[model samples]
Target: MNSFFARRYVITGIFITLAFVLLARLFYIQIIDDRYMLFAKNNVVRTQIQYPARGVILDRNGKLLVDNQPVYDVMVTPKAVKPFDTVEFCKLLDIDKPTFDKYFDKAEKYSPSQRSIFQGQLDSTINAKLGERIAEFPGFELVLRSVRSYPDSIAGQFLGYIGQANDATIAKSNGYYHPGDYVGISGVEKSYETELRGQRGVQNILVDSRGREKGRFANGMYDTAAVAGERLKSSLDSRIQKLGEQLMRNKVGSIVAIEPSTGEILCFVSSPTYNPNLMVGREHGNNYMDLLRSPNNPLLVRPIQARYPPGSSFKPLSALIALQEGVITPQTTYNCPGYYVAGNRRVPCFHNERHGTVNLASAVAESCNGYFDMVFERLINRTGPKNTDTSFTSWRTNVAKFGLGAKLDLDLPGETGGLLPKASLYDKWYGRGGWRSSTVISLGIGQGELEATPLQLANIEATIANHGFFYKPHLIKAIGEKQVVKAEFTQKNYVGIEPQYFEPVIDGMQAVVDRGTAVGSRIPGIVMCGKTGTAQIRHQDNSVFVAFAPRDNPKIAIAVVVEGGGQGARWAAPIASFIVEKYLRDSITRRPSGIEPGYFMNASVLPQPAKPKPAPVKAKPDSTAKPAQAALTAGKHKKKKQPVVYAAAILKGDDDE
Candidate 1:
């Protein structure tokens, strides 16, 4: 009996002590631990993403190039989503049940503390369906987003394209980006991505038991106000771009036109171009895949990326370098027997037909291979292992002045550093191996290893156009009043080829348009000085023409190349002429006869001329028109009339574009 009583007393003591401790803990929870209470309430609260608008892109003339449109995405948090109408839900969203489940599983991969979207950029029909059925499905929600669109799609390549950020992009962007964000991929858009992306905003909302938002947490102070991206004023001319694209149909090469004084690229075209619209929104992946696999390589930016032999286009630099070094004079003479015989071998000229006697100016006018061959050999022999070579260094210096084998700073994405040989490079290449001067003589006729980008070639023409100086080509005009987005010119390659040298070269080039090989491209009143080049590039022949018109005060400098072109004058020269005429004169009348409109190749520019001539009202199909047709017709410009505009120009995919 005594033992039983002792046990009862111990049990009561233990029970009373435990009850008191429980009471104390309850009081602590009610009064001391505010953290748990706050956390419990936060269980239902959420922060939402607020997407800031992307920047608009405009041309120098203030035309809109890129814009954004509203879009939506439907997503489900697996834990939050409840079951009902599984088949109907899948069908409504145009997805299979398995896909829905797959996305739900993917969403669970993220931490439970933060919310993330599953599907993105829902179509309008699905968005409408989601809106009507969203209230019925508890955890299902729609994320509001935006899609990029190009209204005109004119500068597809120049403006580039933007798409959702991938793993690589997210990794590189740091805090500035998330997986679903868009990024610029090429051209000006990629160059100014940060300025165009803008700052994103976030909103946190407080909700009750039924998932209705009650009010802001701490007066919404943690929220961010979305900031818009800055607009860019570009240096693109829409009309000029259109005309150039029209002329480049069925062509494989590039055309780069620059404003000589400003270096603003008027039109930079790579043939077989694609529509810019093909790269935006849901259709991008498909189009991108197709473009990549196509043998044509639509993605290649030929003007800046392709490095090809400058061919005869380089002879001008050689001639100028020789003149600058006093290796030759404008009055220098060379004897030709149709080929240059050095040592024991003869390097053949264009024909068995001999250009019997030639001077520096006449040599250039005639593109006499014999004259350049002698000059090259003389310069080489004067510079080397045998002779005192103060003039040899001058030879390389003068060529460098013409920007050979160097990259010119430009706004475009890819600019190739074209190849020009150096003594050291030759030493490293062939110096130790007994590579002799004979091995490099072909460079004299612009045929050896020297290469240049179309962009650099255009700049070279501008150099001649300006009589010595040239500016670096650029694309963007400005960002706003705060920034003048100009490209700076570097003098690293400036040859210091004096105006005295340029004067004679200009005369030879002028003769090219007036009476020589390029006579078919003659614009009657325009004193266009140009050089035509035919280079054997891989399996195809590349015809290139570089020119600057109104030779005295050049307004435009253009470089054009046509792959598989048989001769420099046939296709390349005419193309260069048309571009110049379109940009400067604003019309062309010289056809097959050099007397009539023939058939207007670029038909859309003018309607039809009243006198059965080229311009169209029934406007004259004047290729080079004044800024205004009336202004041109009112002036000294005349037109030949009445012709079929699209006779042979049955270009595909062009008319619709």
Candidate 2:
């Protein structure tokens, strides 16, 4: 009897221990870890993501620039797919059998049960056809989405575009983004993506065994509504922007204009510009490839990306520095007998003209290379040959105060901080002791390796227009409806030059438009102060100009560059004049003899493609064929760039302009 009681107790104890173990596991699964419960819920619940509509962009004048258009995306759940008539489904989707198979396979690979995008950005016609027959296809559904649309179709590169998110984007989002979502790729679209993309929400609905949607899960307790993105009011003036584009129709450079008081970008144009409409809807990929393959590089944002030597346009800054450093005064005179001779090296003046005696104002008005060269020598060699490096560093630092040799931290992406050489760089090239002011004299004339973008040049002019300070240049002026300006753009940036030092420089600039090299392109009544530059390129010179109007309390500051466009007054000066007139006077009155706006609009400076020669024909030449026509054809074929015509009488004795 004792042995039987012992066996029963031991069996009961073993059973009790087994019961506790099972209870603990059940408790853990129910309360501690909810993965199993989530798994169970996934079998019956369907979660659909609700994407918010992107914000609209407007000009400062309340004109629409970028708006949204409705589109549809076809989503599929591979596991829930019930094979139907493949031919009929393909016909409805406007796709072939092979394409259908490919999309299906891609979807299955991503997730068997989770929804994935099959085809996106379908137009209204496809959306209608597919929507009506969507019920017949068990797993496929249509989801509404929005894509960008440009009404005016300007600023293609500035507004940028959105594209499907890649793996890198997804990994960086930290669960915010999944596959098939879109992200801004560049420009203001990229710079303010977070404010433009908005918040995404989700909806939970009950589902049956075959994945058909039932009523809301738990009376919509788990659902959330999406919030639309904040609207952006950009500082772009549509009128100025449109006119700027028209003026630069056939050019291969950029024009950047800014409001000096506010630093707001009034208008910026990068030539060879394309219609922003090409970046939207079904043909985006093909159109992108076409633009990418263009030889003219219509996609390149030249305002902040293309860097070139500032040339004679850099003289004013050099003059200002010389005055501040006490190396020269406004009355300081330098004699230019065609060339500046330092040891055996001779730096020729503009056209090697003998401007016998010139003060600071006269030197700038005439763009006398020898005058600036001598000024640079004085500034750099101030402390003597033994301390040239120290003086050079001081000059470079002061120049940087004008926002040169560094990136401006522009609101757009892909800005290159233009090349500014340090003392170390010269040390690397010509040892420590070998280089001096005379050795790098080219820098004094704004040649050598120094470079600046058109945007930077525009900013330099704006700084001068404001006397000694400028605001950071920007596009967007307000966020949402609050009309709040960014704090960073409001702060004034001083170039460290005293306000009084800019007077003589302004006087010289006025003389340039009044009776100097740029006289041929001057405005009638406006007190426009300006300077011109002809930067040397490999084949031809790049025309450059910088200017501001009225001389006091200036409204607009501008910079223009025309690649292979000859003298600065030839192409760039007239363009700047036209832009200024449009902004201040609201009309362009004068079409000067050589700098006609109509001529620039119609002329083509782009290089023509090489064509195959026709079979040589030995026929009697017809007398009716004009020599002018024949010459034109030959010139087009033989030369890489077209030669510009000049009225020698009107622009007599003009040098760099």
- Model 1: residues with Cα > 4 Å off, grouped in runs: 1-45, 75-79, 84-86, 97-107, 110-113, 136-140, 209-211, 215-219, 385-398, 422-433, 481-483, 487-494, 591-657
User: What are the per-residue Cα lDDT tens digits for candidate 2 across 557-595?
Assistant: 999998877678777888899889888978888545545
Using TM-score as the measure, which candidate wins?
A: 2
Model 2 deviation from the true structure expressed as Cα RMSD, one decimal place? 8.1
Task: Rate residue 433 of model 1 by lDDT.
Answer: 32
Compose the digit string of candidate 1's lDDT tens values, residues 425-469.
Answer: 555644443344455556677765678888888988988888778
Each candidate's number of clashing pairs is: 38, 0
TM-score, candidate number 1: 0.80
User: Cα-based RMSD of the predictions, in order?
Assistant: 12.7, 8.1
